[model samples]
Target: MTEGTIPAALDRAAEHFAGREALVDGEVRLSYAELARRVRQAARFFEGHERVAICSPNTWHWVVAGLGALYAGATLVPVNTRFTARETIDILERARVSALVITGTFLGTDRLADLGSARPGTVLRIPVEGVEEPISGVTEWDALTGLDSDFVSPAEPDGVSDILFTSGTTGRGKGAMSSHRQALSVAGAWADCGGLTEQDRYLVINPFFHSFGYKAGIVAAVLRGATMLPQRTFDVRETLRLIETEHVTVLPGAPTIHQVLLDAPERANHDLSSLRLAVTGAATVPVALVERMQTELSFDTVLTAYGLTEAVVATMSRPGDDAKLVANYTGRATAGFEVKLGEHDEVLLRGPNVMLGYLDDPDATAKAVDTDGWLHTGDVGVLNERGYLKIVDRIKDMYVCGGFNVYPAEIEQVLSRLDGVAESAVVGVPDQRLGEVGKVFVIPRTGSALSTEDVIAHCEGELANYKIPRFVDFVAELPRNLSGKVLKRVLRKENG
Candidate 1:
């Protein structure tokens, strides 16, 4: 096996920990040897393909399909299972994918059926939970998993391994091409910082399409021989049950997951004593929340990580850092990474984990990463005396209010601390006088009557008048992408 290729790493893990638990999805469990054998078999089935697109929910099959694609020496393109038919078609066309592996149905959505004729080629359907009736003219995923296990393919260390599509918040999403070496760099960084081991049972709540899950969640666990428990969606009860039943030791997700877990009435009923490592991040992580995670959630350490799709595992808070710093600031740069604030406080990064470039789009790639090796992260941040990065907000997410640049993240952080607020997002909208003012959309706590007036009163002393949101709207939930990032573009379209 090639040294830097993913199959090489999997082969090592399988050889060393053949009997160890490797994956758990629903009732099915796979040991390292079994999983690696399946990966090699699936690779043989997919040999001679240049690119393979995978659209599946969080399951053991998803991991197998992804690894199989890599082992086959094909570039893997992971499409969001939640994407619309048009969005799915657009990505396949962009990548010029020769083969496709998709799920049947999940959460009342038939991902494969919905694609319809959009993708009408060699399609392999993974038997997911919802779709009972077998679809016609599609190859079964299980058939491919039973093929020959011994196969080696040629793959350069610098060869592109995966093409991860961006969230497409601003425009049509671009695929960030990542090489085999870059993937290992990201996976290793997460493994070292997370302290992953064979004893750990990692529960990944993030989507498989996102870097947070694909790289940091699964790849990291695979590299360290940790048992993986992937959750399709975040449910307070389900997550607690998984942790209790599986003895989950590592769980990483967005802040919203923790907030719901911390506030669940039945939370006390679950035996979450097995949880020792917790990782969460957002634009603004409340210090109080981190404290509660450590004390209330029984996590040994609560870490906040910062990275983009273009570069995974850039900066992460260390275990012994100050609690306030761990909560609010994205810790020092990872090894082999040079992080600094560029023009206008934009985060500039140069690291081994930086992606190859945006696939087929040289202009976008050039604008994002300059010739001098620095990838221009559009996020605006401050480097404090301790060299920890305090993220203010996305430069694109920032809006001007009354001639003063207002970062919605700062205001949202203050709002998150308010008594009755469950979660909140601030988006800039057209104002008659101020030109652009914040229009805050808030999700009120369960059973609590949190009125717009109450929100206004809470913000009186916490923020400046110009920084305060002029319009307040209450909603059951904020619109978010697969990775749990708030869709401010949708908010602006709804309220602007």
Candidate 2:
């Protein structure tokens, strides 16, 4: 049996489930043997490039390209698909990347033209389902993956497999390095945690760049025998149709995904009996939503997991946990990891799942992962007597009201339970009397009249007066990054 890395795992899967469906993208379906052949064929094309990047949405070509990079002994870098031309190249330059396999014009952005020599590399453009012609001066993705080459690089268990950038909610994103072993360990742990099996059909809604979709979504499915069905973007109607038509068994995404499903009007019309497992995470989860997932959505196993780009899949709820465990806490440390709280209740973690460090930024890395190897995940949370974790909020997201500390997540949790509220975000806005007070922006459920008074009144007895939002503003939606994190910085700057 091949061991210690993704390539090894792929070889094993190809041998075991070679004839089974390995990938499904719209009408294209490839068996494990064909997928492995493409990976091996594409691997021979890398030619030992020092660094390669993939800036594409969820698609089968992205999967083959990424796996081929690994097998070619190249360090794989994932650039955010939402990044602008300049923003994307800035990362490629920082990493000194020599190759980039980017997508064609996608979702209103010409990802290829965005590069424009800002960071020079052997640029390769992958045309998605519809686009048939390859751009001039770029290698055709089909021509590359079609070659049947007998090649496999040596196992690189300790070598860096990926350099995932921080979400950069605050400022410039920092690249975090993960070894082949560390990355694969997270994938294996997630597959086991979710009880994924060969019979599973996984629909990946999260982007390929994020840790959730890259390691947990794509790699985990390959490690197990699950069929991968990639979605480019999250559209409510499209997601429901895929779930019903494809019989997607395992669908994992951010909490917003589940919330949308629960709130969608045509939900009852679709026969979604195949959605058996769902994995989600957020700052605050209302218990009612969890119940609705199990009862209304008919999900047999609904889990909430916690992890950052630095350490993906740290903790996750398990099957048969109570509503409180499923909705309240992010669950105890997943297998092969340790979790503790720092002085101010910041969640501290250390394990194989943890990243090596921020690439080429030792000072920032030293500050995050202490000399003892504990990664200080800036997010704050509390562990109950039973050891379940309830994430309060980002420590930086917390603010003082009337000289008392207040956490936005605590208030948001209360706000979500209120009638007519679909979602809410609380940020500290300037206030004369208290230095800084909470200002909440809410998105009302469809067809409901949620007023500012309705929001303020809902928090009356449910929260401390200091924690209550002094100002309430109803908006169509809160500004969020592609990863589904509320851009509180944007909120703070707008309301500052």
Candidate 3:
């Protein structure tokens, strides 16, 4: 089994699986030895930087740049590609990023121009879809690759490796810091559970910016020497083509991704017999969907898991589990984690893989992890006698929409700034397509006229598309408790 820092893991993979294919992104294919060489070259560009941020879709460039930063002993901070310029700038400033690796013109948006003056001191622009208008002062991806240096920073096991930002109930984003040991431990646990091997061709559909893709997808593949086929964006046709051509054996994503593939009209025309494993979670997994994946999609093993940014891959179903069990419950705890129910049936986790703490927030850290070292996951769940975990509700008033965590407080804070919006409350309502969609109840200020379009338009400028409310309702007043706290339960109940 591979152990120690991420950089060490990469070197081990290069030595053990030197001739094996490592990454296949579009036309770029690299062996383990070649990937190590490129990572070392890229590391020299980020040698002096302390924090490096990557804001791009999943591709070969993202993997190289991210691993390079880690090789240089720089903390990696991945920014969401869907975030607006303002939102991205906020994270960059908070993390004190000194270097940035951004996509050059993707989907008609020039990310370099969007960042403007807020960009870090050192910027490496990846020509993902070819740079439309070359911006001066920004180093192109090719330029960085050409640089030569033998600088390799020694990474400590306990040193912080990455800071992944997740929204808090306070309407602020909290950076969850994890050490090299913690990150690898969880990745190894996940890889072991999934039976990842060198012969496996894993198709990573999850965005690299998210924990699922970065740690579980990238790090796990490196640990097991699995070949990675990264998809820049999720397209049904492209996914089918990759499975047939690349002989993809492992596919893990949200239930929605599988549902789309199964429901696609042209699904039968493609060859999908190569698929062997499917791991899904982040939202409700229907029993029918899991059964169909086995029967219709020919997936040998289908599993479901429950985790948060703080403790990724805490609990996961095993391979032999039935479809009904896999769909109904996120499997028993793995990765040396102890799971138990606390007050109100809240799921409490204590493990080595839990995050060290929220970045620079001691107060919040103390609130999350008690002195007993048990991290109080605000999610309410049930633990069966057999040690399975079934998530029931979220105490944090958060929801999962299309596999993305959406905090109502974050949206309410953005709406509070909008003109003619005196007060607002947001809740997650059931949806047929997406597991849940945001529905905001707004109380307009006296003598102010506000339409649903106006409220949505205001949010579009300030928030990510997933964070914005899909449905808006204008109300005269909000329901509250005696202490004047907004009764969100009442709102959710009424909406449901």
Show the lowest summed lDDT stretch of 10 residues, model 1. 398-407
Off by over 4 Å in 1: 130-132, 167-170, 398-496
Model 1 C-alpha lDDT versus the unseen true structure:
0.83
lDDT of 2 by residue, 1-496 (tens): 2368888888888999999999999888989998888888878878679788999999999899998898888889998775666567778989999888987778765768757657454777788635745556677677785676798676489989899986333435689999889888888888988999999999998888888889998789988989999998888899899999999999887666787888899898998898899987744567888898889988899998888778888888888898878888998788478999997999999886788889898988898899888999877889988777888756667675543446687678778789898898898987644557899998989999878888888787555466779898989978889999889999998998
Pairs in clash, predicted candidate 3: none
The segments of candidate 3 whose C-alpha lies over 4 angstroms from its true place after superposition are 1-3
Q: Write the per-residue lDDT of candidate 1 for residues 28-57, one digit (tens) a residue.
A: 899999999898888897898989999887
Question: Pick by TM-score: which candidate is best?
Answer: 3
Could you arrange the candidates by lDDT from highest to lowest? 3, 1, 2
Worst 10 residues of 3 by lDDT: 145-154
For every model shown, what is its TM-score relative to the native structure? 0.81, 0.80, 0.98
For every model shown, the clashing-pair count is 0, 0, 0
Q: Write the per-residue lDDT of candidate 3 for residues 1-496, one digit (tens) a residue.
A: 2248999999999999999999999789999999988998889998988899999999999999999999888899999999999989999999999999999778888877888898988899888886456677888888866778465666778889999999999878999999999989999999999999999999999999999999999999999999999999999999999999999999999999999999999899999999999999999999999999999999999999888899988999999999999999999999999999999999999989889999889999999999999999999999888999999889899998989999998899899999999999999998877899999999999999899999999999988888989999999889999999899999999888
Clashes of 1: 0
Instruction: Using TM-score as the measure, name the better of candidate 1 and candidate 3.
Output: 3
Q: Which pairs in model 1 have colliding backbones?
A: none
